[model samples]
Target: MAQCVTAFKSMLQARLLEEKLASLYRAGGRIVGGVYIGKGQEAFSAGLAVHLEKGKDVYGPLIRDQAGRLAFGEPLLDTFRTYLGVITGPMRGRDGNVHRGRPREGMPAMISHLGSLLSVVNGMLFARRLQGRLGDSVGATSLGEGGTSTGAFHEALNQAAIEKLPVIIAIANNQFSYSTPNSRQFACGDLLDRARGYGVQGYAVDGTDLTACVSVFSEAVKRARAGGGPQLVVGSLLRLSGHGEHDDSSYIPDQVKSSPLGQDCLPYAESQLKASDLITDEEVRKWKDEFLMEIDAALAQASKEPTPDPFRENWRALSTAGLVEGQFEA
Candidate 1:
């Protein structure tokens, strides 16, 4: 294994953990006020995204919230621009929210179906093969553990196994998928364990454990890169908060919320490093203050910026394209 820098990784992890704390302040003002801040689950998204970017990988997000997207590579302004209906918003503010990630140039536009993106994964692989780019291309899809019970999951695994397409399907099993407890959705205690039956490697990790998450995803990415076919990782991330904007996550607890995995990314990474004497507590506090100040400045800047004109030139350009008449559609 290559000697990867741990200090920056720790800092990066800390920056991510800052979500739980900061989101609390902005949740009420956010689109779906009180967004599901996956406190302890930050590492899963980070690790998975880091791995996928090893190649020109495509992220097929399925309503798994925007944390993963932001961590994966979506710009900060693009994220906030989403609320303002700005063209800079991913997809020009069209398509669904949550999985509303920008396309990687030639990648397919994101679909809103729950687990249906699996078919797109297969199709993408097929198209790449036709173009003699199969080995050079790869697909990555993400879904909640809840979506695993759906038929799409089986179809994806079976097809990928039979065809030997390169893909990395990450299941962010954030304990509870919305209001429904995971137990109600499946009989399997661990979803990753099912990967072996489909003729691919499967593994589970403590999604909160950033180091472990990084190592696991790194290995999976290496395998996929070497054309070992697709792999499945069931990230057992603790949902320290509620399922979404509506329900109270009384099923979990505030105590669970205290840990790095349960609260958010930045602090977890900070605390972990601090515990291991990787960085000083003062340095952690400085980093937190710096990030918060940056956020405050960004929000303040956003407050002063002019709202985009609904009838701006791009809007007019769209109107002239017979978009309302559906000229672009097949």
Candidate 2:
């Protein structure tokens, strides 16, 4: 019950923060890159994140994983700093806002190619195993239905299966990939079918059902940590928003919008908590108020902070520390 409440709170915080980010983006001249919110997928994202150990497990989040990032221990201020181009962010404001992460803390900085993240997490877990330090630790990464079609996804999952690595891959089948619906993405009948082909354990859950997400993700993490090899969770839901703030999402059909999958997870989560006697409407309101104030303060602080100056910044990559300027040219 406590875990569910905490995860729900993180989802609520992410939703509120993303909402503010959308408003900031719409106002113009405030944000740097695209504004993508998880919207209806928050429950599924947060569910996986809340179960992982921050310092031990590797988490590779995609563009729409604000909820997971928060639940995985990313500071609220970091999100604002990254989006607002504050030089103190994880990326030092040198990368896109959505590409921010703290690698040393087990979360790799995301690249534009979401499918590649699976291999990134696999490499990290494989490295820990090689060092004889992979004691019950697992690595998890997320993707959309579209990402599953990429070759990187297939190769990485195969690698994990072959090596019997503890890894969890969460796929949010949010009905559409960008403006493309699932019909155009793949013809597997169900995304879980891919899990069988990969020889990994698979779980399917309703992305809008907070309780189901919490239950499913918990089991997935547990199985992975217990040396069950890779686990795949395919969540069914709708994006509920545009691919970015620039899009109005007119592509989504009205029938799809009215479907059960289109239900907003945030309010549904609140209702779940209330029914379980874990939280009340008044408490939910208080949480929203508190989170909004915190978000406002963080944004204000980040807005006033300095941005990166190209001339004064070190252009060298962190991994090239031991090499001289001309050493790699040979």
Candidate 3:
């Protein structure tokens, strides 16, 4: 229990980090309309990220906020640049919504067509298998509850299962699809059962349980490494905000039921830690203050991030090699 407390407090700190990054992105010069926040669902993102290898594993992230990306070592300015479409971004400011984000050391760049990218991951798996690089590689995809209804979900899951590919399909069911609720979305009480049809291993965990989430993702990582194909993890996370920018909270129906705002995975962990003899209240206080300071520092430094390169407007044609012979000849 004490150990759980220690791990728990750290989990809260991670959530705080994510929140700070979200705020920075919202007001940042770049990524004005591209602010993706994982405020209530910190556990699954931070926990799973902790277990996977940054360089070897490729991530397909739709939850495009700085926290998730930062876990993989992405700098604040670079992410801002990516969101704002600046040339200085890792993807040369070319990556954006549906633009498989800048290919980093560990994760794949964000590709807009989420479901189809599974095929790309499978192709990478096949290549790795043929090259005798037959080790573990987790290709994580974050899907809201609404995505499961798409034919793409069925197709991606089926392809991975048939090929016995190494992928972990993580469904972050924060429970709302645009304006509709989960019941309106699916009859299945949990999304885990849906993957069973494809012979995929499935687990539906408490999205707020940080330790549980980490353990499950770690196991999934292990199985994929051992040629065990794919695992479907539908973690029920708390949603603190609506779908995206420009959304107003006045519309969310109250009688239909709602979660407490601070029902966040990280704060929950912190409270649990305080209840037990983990590190004493002082430790928690120290960590919280320390994390806040780091966030302030990140915010301050992020402001100083260089603006996107001015001469990168031709970035698209250059990166895609979509050049025509003598097209730019003087």
Candidate 4:
């Protein structure tokens, strides 16, 4: 009951923050680069993140992983600071929103190229193996359904299987990659079948259901931790918002987008909670208010962070320790 409440709290906070970012972007706030929301996939990411051992297991979170990242201790204020280009924030306002991670803390920042995340995480897992600490480490990463078709995804998965690395490859099969739907992406009935070809275990999950996602991810993480090798997990969900705030996501079908069952993960979880009698309306309202207040305070503080100083920022972007005198001039 406690874990379920925490999971719901994480999801609610993630959803609210993403919506806040969208609102800020629309209102011409300090947001730079793109604004992507993990609104519909909150349960999936949060489920996987909560199962991993914080200081021991490593994972790379994509843009749609705000909840998971937050659950792992990424500051909500830092998230806002990254987008607002605050000098006092992580990335020193250098890396843009959600493109940052704390490697020392086991969260490798994700690259914009979604397909590359798998290989990067696999390498980290491989490094642990080389150090003979493989038993102590497990890795997880995410990609969209479209990314599975990329060469990097196949190569990484193939290598992980052959090496018997403890890595979990999570694919968010939201049926569409940006404007392109699954039909145009691949002919395969399910992405999980690719796991068989690679000789690893695979699980297809209903990403919206927090209980199911958390259970599956927990099992996979435990198996990997026990030296059972890598697992491929595919999550099927809907992209409630656009690929970015700039996009209206009009390409998605109206019926699918409008369907509460398909569009929102929160309500699904709420229904489950209600059915189980695990929560009351008053409790839910209290939790919601708490998260909103927390977020409001974080954002308020984040907004006060000033932009980086141009002169001080230039040297910060590139270290001068090993550079030649002439190189510094440029």
Top of the candidates by TM-score: 2
RMSD (Å) per prediction: 4.6, 1.9, 3.7, 2.2
lDDT of 4 by residue, 1-330 (tens): 555656777888898888889989998846877888898999888888877777788889887898888776677887888888788776777788878877777878787776787777888888878888767578988888888888888888898898898888778888889899898999988898888989999999999888888889888988888888889899988888889999988898888776653757887788888789887788889988988898899889988878888786545334664464545553
After best superposition, candidate 2 residue 100: deviation in angstroms?
Answer: 1.0
Clashes of 4: 0
Name the runs in model 4 displaced over 4 angstroms: 258-263, 316-320, 324-330
Look at candidate 2 and tell me the lDDT of residue 231: 97
TM-score of 3: 0.81
Task: Please report how far candidate 1 places residue 207 from its true position, in Å.
Answer: 1.5
lDDT by residue for model 2 over 231-320, one digit each (tens)? 999999999899999999999999999999999999999988999999988998899999999999999888889988989886787577
lDDT tens readout by residue for model 3, 275-327: 65455678777878987787667555544555456573543455435364555
Per-residue lDDT of 235-303 in model 1, one digit per residue for the tens?
Answer: 776665555546567876556455543645445655766676767867656755765666566545544
Could you tell which candidate, 2 or 3, scores higher by lDDT?
A: 2
Better of 2 and 4 by lDDT: 2
Give the winner by lDDT. 2
Worst 10-residue lDDT window for candidate 4 reads: 313-322
Candidate 4, residue 88: lDDT? 76
Candidate 4 has what TM-score? 0.93
